[model samples]
Target: MSNKIKLTVLGLLITLNSLKAQQTSNKSYDVCIYGATSAGVVAAYTAAKYGKSVLLIEPGKHVGGMSSGGLGLTDIGNKYAISGIALDFYRRVGQHYGQFEQWIFEPHVAEDIFHTYLEKAKVPVLYQHRITAVKKQGNVITEILLESTGPRSVGRVKAKMFIDCSYEGDVMARAGVSYVVGREANTAYGETFNGVQLTNGHQLPDGIDPYKVKGDAKSGLLWGITKGQLAEKGSGDNKVQAYNFRICLSNDPKNRIPITKPAHYQPERYELLIRQMEKRTWKSLQDVFIWSRMPNQKTDINNRNGFSTDMIGMNWDYPDADYRKRQEIWSAHTDYTKGLLYFVGHDPRIPEHIRAEMNEWGYPKDEYMDNENWTHQLYVREARRMKGALVMTQHHCEGREMVQDGIGMAAYTMDSHNCERLVVNGMVKNEGNVEEGGFGPYPIAYRAITPKETEAANLLVPVCLSATHIAYGSIRMEPVFMVLGQSAALAAVKAIDGKSAVQEVDVAALQRQLKENPLADGSAPDVLIDNSDSFRVKVSGKWSVQKRGGYGPDYFLSDGHTDSSSFIRYYPDPNIKGRYEIYTYYAKLPERKAVTAVKVFDGKRLQEVVIKDEEVKVVGQTSGEWVKLGDYIFSGNGKPYVEITGNGEKVAADAVLLVAASK
Candidate 1:
């Protein structure tokens, strides 16, 4: 056996031993979490920091879910939406790459960072443990029975508070919490793009036929095509969005494996792809799959236009299915994805250039060694969303309605994968794809995570929070989930101390805790002043506010001139007298200034310095960055600010950061 295999066995043995030890003791915990995903890990770490014993259980062996799986090309709508532990996770990843902040990284690197959190917090994790049943007193979950495959791993865990962090919300469903499976009608929540959308995204061209033989009514429909008539545009249904693997592949010859035919491979399952490909003048695989680049020559390839990796209409049974049935669906997705990849590269009907280009990529040898170098986590985009206290609707995302008691913010687009592939007007087409963005970050209400007062009192659902189907699409992202998880942990601690239900916890106190103690350890937070802060910012002349490639919510672009008439200044308030290191954000724009100069004010003196652009640049995938100018001492009563000196060519003013010297 190889050394990697030995290490894999040794790790499993260690986890089994830990589970056995904890089960024999039959000890209760202060907080118990189901699903050790990215959100669950953060929740457990936060609870441990608050001096609570946390038991994190997972149905699988590994952690970090899709964050470590393959969705490394982060879906960050704006950097302004991330903060606290969620921001810290990305910063830690940035540190690994020797930069200020990194939005993308490797799989093993992400998983290792998650392990670091567990080790530092001393949180016990039980692998392969699924909730069999729940024992409750009144509305509170007293204990839960586990069905583990490992020896002596099946036991009950008693806890004061329980958090359901799984993507499917299994624990929340098993506890009899109210939830919904699929999309709701547009009229149900005043949403424009919620149910049964037949938009022009990831759709097939108009002439492709659905039958096995062209122009034959007797021939049956091709494989993977849904058998249903088109529904009304705004009608509701129980159908679910597609789910697939975010396959990680590499181009490095020394660290790659061939894309061989997988087990139970069926070539006919991808018949629609072949028919779709023959019609279009496809150049290469890039037109078929998005070739998003990651660090170390790896790619976070995902579904693209027309026919791709998404197994549409095959995941409808996943949200509410049992363990055995879910596993079957999971295996089917795995086989279908692998089959799609292999068939594209080997089938003769495909274009020669496409097959040649697809052959250059394979599984990364150094990642996911425990699962044959394939990601074990499937991208379940939207599942069973909880019907909690206050459901967030599209009005909230559109800024028409706002919530003051927000625990976190979400900034991604209202994105949904195609739900089904059908023949519309006798032509093969895909439906239920939605992608809408161009709004600012909206606050996620605190009540969204808590269940109804009558359903269950002590449970918090972070991953599957309460929201309308279309609204949930915008709020469901990994970073947003992590932020919600940390907030859930804080609320759990507050509920335990107050001896009250989750819904009854003080919202004002919880928000104070989040802002004052972001890391949950009383560490002082760095002062930040963005261009969006109109209260602390003074702008002059015709500076246009542009987003797309700017820092925070938006950045100010000079009116195509280097003059004082179009300049911006940021006033930083540290709230306490101290020596601080200040930095300015440099946005990536079309115009580049050769020598961009910035003026820093320190109570009594104003100093100008050219930005050290070479000293601070994002290593791999990010566009915007932070450049440190210098440190200054500030008086408690003085107003210190940074002004972008419009001396060079065109310039962009984004945001400023003030870090204490003590940090």
Candidate 2:
């Protein structure tokens, strides 16, 4: 046997012997987390930081899954959502870029940071330990079976609680928990953006078809285009979101690695892309949306325009694929993407301009040098979603509904890429291709992360929660996953202390903990309109209005004060009850305007309102004068009032505030 294999076997033998000896004794841990995913690492570190003995088991040789892998460009929706240890990771990354090390995308930098954190927390992470089975007792999980690859032996771990931090939900799956793989029907949850999108967004140019041949009736439809099948609209499909390698590329001639032809490079495989290029339908890589981290020597090249790096409409089988099958899928994806680059750079089929431009780009030698300088991880956008205690849908994100059991907050817009399949309505299209802007951040319910009672009692799935495809689009971000991971660890600790199942844990208590130890990342702009503020309210139509009053009688607006000399007064028309609508046409301003606040009053109190300013301006266009920035409605908690205010008396209102009955 080879020396590496010999060492691996010896390591496994030692591990097995140690585990067997410990089994005879009473060596138990407070918490155990399977999978050394980014979230898993955070879970273990956070739990250990909180004084919990954590046994972190990583099946793969690598610790940080996608984070330290290829996904160097972080997908943080709202930076504020990142708090706790998650923010600590970024802060540490920021620190590395201080004066000497300008580039922070180096794999060693990230790995070193994670190692230092684990060392600091005194958390023990065992690599090459795959969790094969989970043994449960009554309402609690007793022991988990971990198979070692080095010695090829099995070891068992007994812990008070378990966290299925693996992206595949390995522990939860092995425990026989109820989960889902593909898109759900719109009718199942009355959702609009769940399965099989076919609409073109603002990014994709118009009149461009997604079909293979331009209405070729003789040869029939082209390859890669899924059409002619009898399919219902807005119905569920056996499809999942796309996944890709977070390629860390460098342009520094010294460290840059040029595109290489794979051993299995097939010219025929790139026929479609070549055809698209010939048709002038392909979007160049350099032209793709570039989000720079510390100015343009480096950038996070995301899937932008029509045909970027997002291998959509082909990843429908990932959420439910087995291990071996997942590997095959990964290999196929890597070949396709890497081959695409090779073809673009050297293939004769590619256009001259595109080839010349592609030649100028190469891999970043400064990053991920261990694996021949290639990114170690693929960015799996969506995977197996757990059917937990509560499900988060688009309505929750759209402010149509509110989650009372909020353990954490999601401050990102509902974002998803195009899942195009074929041509429709005489045009090439894809569904779930929405990029609607202007919606404010909303709260993510804690219940969405908890598993069902029948599932593993101690298991908490924060990354892959019970959310629809559209909803997961917003929550699948890395920072959000880290925030939820911290919250999950906190919940695990509380559940262990209470000696109750994960589902049985009090959500109110969880919410309390989160608020008490909120992420100290940043602060929200201090902007609230109370009774102290005065106003010059304007009105139009059959309704009446006031400036500095609230929802009251003669005041014509809700009565509240924000600051001294600055109060708002609102009054609802007796003729209108239930639901009332208002419009603000225009406003004049005072001076000290730091931010803007719009409050709605409901006789007794202030209701949900929106606040805006330069720091938090609403982008893009809107339907009405009011863009409906935030629903701001909360259940079981009432601040029912209506008023708009700024720091100084200087405020501008363009539209009139109209209140009509709810229809």
Candidate 3:
């Protein structure tokens, strides 16, 4: 059947389901998780595992959000910081592939893992149940009404607690939660990278024109080009970050389905891309096409460089738009992306080599079988972020501020995708792509997910929790979402047990529980060092102590300008003796020095060894973990020590671990 006809039939089935569900009475549960995303599924599994009745409500036919969608190439920064249910999910994915754990896999494989987790937890999922209305009584949510789109009709779910795990924060917004869309000013939260960043990074090729007619001011701006005076940097605005589909493409003939022009292909929409190609402004198509390898030779394709997969400036209305409007936006994105693919593969204007390369890849026929080989979920990178009891800001991610009641940790860079395509100095430039990093793993406060007491007391927002734009960029990773989902579930359970508001849950108790509960395999590390232990420091310039969660609460950072004369040294116990491998843990950030020199003093010799600190590379997948420096022999009576000297870049000096290597 044609795509339109299939959608019509699906709509009719949903109407019939809604009508059927309206005839039944309201069902009660201990927890109602709206939007069966990866976060929602994990929340349901967690609540159900704790013996609470969970209703997993999904607005669409499928679940598992982006993970089950085409975003199979995980964007994990510090994999070691990921534990509990988040780690379990990856381990399950690994199990399916006959490995200990698989970080990259097929979309269907991820969906299978979600299904297994939910099924094992015995949680029932209600598909096509979009939350229509949320009933609130004073401070608590009384119930939620869902309109069915398939076989069930209108259904009411009464739960003591509700978790908004949707990417859009639909349920939370309906429940009168305060949320802010788009970018906030840096001054609003003392953040340097928050708002209106036109010149920040991710600029298009230097000479691309903004007008449809080159050099003609009267000519209207090209499609997708915003014509306006660029906003001052660090100022707040309503423009949201870009969104796209994490497309799954394949080169294997057995699975590849060649990109075809959409039914409503609009060549004019791609005028800018064609212009760039014709002008020979870009080096290669690969500059825009970032295809990361997934399992089975498939690829999780993403937008990169200038004018890529991200439909810039088209998703501002998505967070608040009604269901029908969202469908329209989704269709527009699909057409734009598919058209780009088709143009790259067929347009003669594209270089022949690039065209040939594009033609080799297409949608994987075996994936997204139910959705015409397209991913069901859109990459809603940023949307309506809730302004909860505690708003997480760049300060938190940078370790300038720390949350004592941290439920989990996020260790990724404070990254933001391009937010606007603007006319700058008579040329087209993409704005708001700030990729700042330096701070290590930071804690996610429980209060950040909890709504204010005056708002709904029972609601917890995990995916769309309280955070600034730059901070959200780091927190929006799938693994971090899963971690927050599990933490939200535990907090809900605690609130229910204590008969207290979600905002009033005892934080100390929550922290204690979280720390005490190790992984199911009992592999969590024990706290061995006290915070009071101080390393002797001699600084020629300046240094400061910064505390974050995954970095064992305290670490030292050099000033942005590093000098060779500045260094920090630490002396080990005088009695230590044996061949030991030295490992240094620092926040892996893009802005870190490519190499940091560590002066090691072994009993036999003193030598300087260079350590590569770039965290972006997948070297042993040890971004946040202990990175080995070198093995050295220490005498039992000598004062063995190590010194870190600056190399003119940002340097993080967290605690070092000395493991005994086999002699």
Model number with the top lDDT: 1
lDDT (10s digit) by residue, model 3, range 1-663: 554565565455434433433433366778988888888988888888778878777888776899899888787766655767887788678668775456788987887688777767877777777888989899899998878776555468898999999999998899998999989888898888889776535567677888888888799899998766788888888888899998888889877888888789888887878766655455655677777778787888888876788999998899999999999999999999999899888887777888898888888877776688899999999889999889999989988899998988888888888888978888888988888876667899988998888998899999999998889998899888988888888889888988989988888887776566533222332222222256443445567776543345466677867678777776677677777777666554545677777887764578887877554233223344455567777778666677787666677766666655541
lDDT digits (tens) for residues 562-600 of candidate 2: 243343444333233344445432222222244456666
Stretches of model 2 off by over 4 angstroms after superposition: 1-26, 99-108, 149-154, 202-223, 227-230, 281-284, 288-296, 418-420, 423-432, 518-663
**Clash number by candidate, in order:** 0, 84, 10
Instruction: Quote each prediction's TM-score.
Output: 0.95, 0.72, 0.79
| lDDT of prediction 2 | 0.61
Q: Is candidate 1 or candidate 2 better by TM-score?
A: 1
Show model 3 residue runs off by greater than 4 Å: 1-25, 278-284, 518-663
TM-score of 2: 0.72
Off by over 4 Å in 1: 1-6, 9-17, 20-25, 547-549, 574-581, 590-595, 603-623, 630-638, 661-663
Compose the digit string of candidate 1's lDDT tens values, residues 346-428: 98988888888889989888888878889979999988999998999888887889998899998778888899889899999
The deviation in Å at residue 485 for candidate 2 is 0.9
Which is better, 1 or 2, measured by lDDT?
Answer: 1
Residue 329 deviation, candidate 2, in Å?
0.5
